[model samples]
Target chain A: MDIHEYQAKELFTEAGIPVPPGEVATTADEAEDIARRLGGRVVVKAQVHAGGRGKAGGVKLADSPEAAREYASAILGMEIKELIVKKVLVTPVEDIVSEAYVGVLIDRANQAPLFMVSPEGGVDIEQVAETNPDAIRKQSVDPRYGLLPHQAYALADFLYDDPKLVRQATKIVGQLYDAFTKNSCSLAEINPLIVTPQGEVKAIDAKVSIDENAFYRLPRVEAYRDLDAEPESESRAREAELSYVKLDGNVGCCVNGAGLAMATMDLVKYYGGEPANFLDIGGSSNPDKVVAALQIITADPSVKAILFNIFGGITRCDDVANGIVEATRRIDIKTPIVIRLTGTNEAEALEILGEAGFSAHTSMDEVVQKAVQIAAQA
Target chain B: MSVFIDQSTRVVVQGITGRDGSFHTHQMVAYGTQVVAGVTPGKGGQTFEAGNGARIPVFNTVEAAVRETGANASAIYVPPPFAASAIMEAADAGVALIVGITEGVPVQDMMTASALVQDKGVRLLGPNCPGLISPGKSKVGIIPGEITIPGPVGVVSRSGTLTYEAVNQLTQAGIGQTTCVGIGGDPIIGTDFIDCLEAFAADGETEAVVIIGEIGGTDEQDAARWVKDNLNVPVVGFIAGQTAPPGRTMGHAGAIISGSEGTADEKIRTFKESGIAVAERPVDIRDLVKEGLGL
Candidate 1:
């Protein structure tokens, strides 16, 4: 759900937020052309998902179009914080007098939307919070009442000293809140909302995470989903309706729930094995889903073993056990399968597996240890 | 003596005509829950029954079921997209408690639905949780029936599978739960640790409470304060996210980028100050809860 700076700026512009005119260019020649069109003095920013591009030498300033082209050529395809730079955002450089941060999110505890404003911006907000907590002002907005002008003004006052600047800041905060509520954004942030010497406030950078659950209502936003951007196994898992996330290990894990999957990974590591992935088969035990999960795990050559720790409740343990017993036949699982079955029909599940010549354990520790040992051998 | 649903609590199943709706409904009934009515949008006047075909009438809406059968609690199996509307319908019908087992309900919808439910004085447990089960008492939602052993440890967690992990750990460590609730993995859940803490505080059967929280949100801090000020009962807390970083989203859609204040270290420090024992490892939750109870 994270878009590059250029993509975020495109969204901000569509929302009528003032941003410097910019064009995304993949080639050095194209970047120079774009820089010339923006009057030769432009900032070349690497397009990556992560922040701190400037500090990482992924951002550069060009005095002329040729310089922009050189910078673009140097950055293109370069790995910046693990993200390969495919394009560069070339924009007209701006004069900034001050910078501030503003963001909105749903405060679950109070059951209200919360808006935060900090006097200092552009740097990591966590440092500001740790160093000077009082500088950050927060307001919880009632959904029924919405974020009013007074609340925005109160935050704006903290963010600015001059009356004109305060007024402009308040308007921007209002607009940000509008975008947050309307777009179903879990977080809508304007980091380093800059103020030029002319006393105008504009959102210089935008970071947004639209609520994925709200994707049905916002088809246009859902279109922004880049399946290719994700790991191949993950995108494939999604297509199969299995929840899977890649982890930093070699042993592939398959569990029934998110919490259990994480615990399984943690336990694997505890028992001296690195979990390669986190996969949840959900509550259903359809053999097809199991086969799909096995296929995804086996697809990763790093996977030395597979662990199935399922506490079947709605999903009968027998169903999962059967699925595993059946999945091995459908998919060629090169890795060892360590199964832990518990809950409803667990006895039947064990019997079913025992009949199939599969040795599954009732204890989680035993199963996890076995997987780790098997992986170590591999 | 348990919090929320007990054996006497009358249950109503929403979306009971569907596959999951029917399956869990039957399982709950078989586990000895007093399931009195089923609600499906277009199927009114028909009846669905479990054991021995002892019929319970189906209604088109939650209000109709409540009026006809006096069903006061609801377990919703409606899919993610329609879950918000279903919960709203249950709240409108004046169900005292609702447990939504459906996952993937957009956090925004849950936020709005939670507010609406709160406005109507209805308590919601979760949208993506495994539901709540009080052994030999009442079962609502979909926690496995066989894994529970009715005891004094009140369990609460943000993840369904982690709830099972805590329960299994407790079971292995010779600790049993009074009632275990999966608050859900989603960041903006219907209920939080504070709400569950309040319930455990008042429940006579709960000798101690075990809480499992994740990396995002300030709920852990809030719960720590609540446990310190209001509750006399012993509490043990284990906050997840040892390897997690701030401003990074985790598994749950509701989880992520909550800021430095909601980190695991901060929460653990606060909980320690509040006199609650902090479990260093998730597997130690049961031992911590047991020790907190002086067991």
Candidate 2:
């Protein structure tokens, strides 16, 4: 779950990390008021869950309160990476002598939280790691023991030369670590940890991604999820307990497992047809979930063909067949559905579909090809 | 001949009173697995009839079940919130192999649980996996028993139904398996491709190995490198999610493509470079496996 910059900075401040004073505004008038309160000079950054906002013209420096309003008006409704900017964060401008990068993320390879600190800041860290590998120093911190003071200082020392600056950066690193673990974040970044001319180090920008699995434990962090930023179909799917990701294609896929769902989508492409979405109805074959999945898929006007490739293990094929039959009665589905049902009472499921005046395939390849052909014709 | 569980493996079912636990427990028992005991915390001292008039004793704790039944292996069907503790408990009870069937266990919990299992020298299979089947010998988790037959090929995958798809096709082609293992689809899992590969290499019955990987971390790449350096058995590989978009998780939490890493294209390239036959589609796995076995 990605949080906006303002929310991440709020967390940073709560963790005792120094951040430029900021306020989130949903309107241009609110942005001007915030800028005025912050002594007129501010940076208006579009609060959207995407990277390269600056390059996309979603960020600007406002020399006066009126300029802040102008930047806010330009950025508020702008779309960056398909996400609409509903709000802008107005922060007081900082006098920076140097900028550096500091972040902590779950290193999947090491199976631990890894702290990556670099002297270079405000650019893609992956590019830096590829171009100048030595500039980035990484350390894996044991979660049980937490990030130790020495580990934080070592990362700070890699980013700074002045003793006073190192001390401040070390404290900030510790605070960032605290924020990371406390929030159950998969990623916590404070890019451009700026050093002022007067030698004070502070975080100028913040980003955090919370682990969805940890939401059960972290209620506060879970509450930070902005539903308005997400697509309506995605939210509806989540509520229905279905795993669905919308894509740009014509064939809509509904499968039982994650890997099989993806394979089904790939098969759709293999047959010269694009998949409209990735939808996994999960292990259980609750008829309502299937109905909800179908409704979600058909809601997209681009979905010309719907495909159900179910290899029932824990899921019962009969239940899914019943769902397809029941859904046709409850909802008016205009798109054609191609189903490949096998395993776990498959014979019974095929009989159910047959009685409902529907034909079903027993092979994945055949069903996918049939669906693709139908979608192409449609 | 099995890499992990065999005919001699005595199993204990965790969360036996729960919905998924009881259902799969019945399936495991029906498949002729020696389901020695069950653990349901509060439902100890009770008996769960497997609808075949077979009464299995249920214990309150894994330690109690292990002590009473001498259960050597355990299959977990506990929920995500308690799955980590369940794995740790199984390890603490000295279970040799633990297969966790619970999905959605927090990554941090699995990390800690994995560390504990390693310390105890116990082999943990998955926290969200479909578990392993030793063909006609022993069935552990939710993999249907009828789809597999005891034969020469060994299979390892990070998926559930996709593994079944491969197994089904292999069975249809008259190619049976020694063991089919699902290492789970999470970012962190107990058993990895390399672990299963080494085990398959040691098993005399497993003449060849089939590895099913998806887009995610560099586990496949690392496993490819391991196969090159360590094993002598022929390996056939297939990576799912060729059409998966970047940054979007394709159903599986660990199936997201992140920053120039863990793509199906890259994994296929690595497999080819490492001398493993890469299948373009799931239907092609059987033919590749047959080629690997020289059949």
- For model 1, the superposed segments whose C-alpha errors exceed 4 Å read A227-229, A351-357, B165-177, B228-250, B255-295
Tens-digit lDDT track of model 1 for B17-70: 888888888888888899999999899999897665657789999999999989
Report the C-alpha lDDT of model 1 over A86-118, residue by residue, as the tens digit. 878998887899889998877767767889899
> What lDDT score is found at residue B161 in candidate 1?
65
Q: Candidate 2 chain A: minimum summed lDDT over ten consecutive residues — where?
A: A220-229
**Runs of candidate 2 exceeding 4 Å displacement:** none
Each prediction's Cα lDDT score?
A: 0.81, 0.92
lDDT of 2 at A70: 97
Task: Please report, as a residue range, the 10-residue window in candidate 2 chain B with the lowest summed lDDT.
Answer: B245-254
Q: Candidate 2 on A159-275: residue-level lDDT in tens?
A: 988999999999999999989878878889999899999899999999898879888998887888898788899999999999999999999999999999989999899889999
Chain B TM, per prediction:
0.93, 0.98
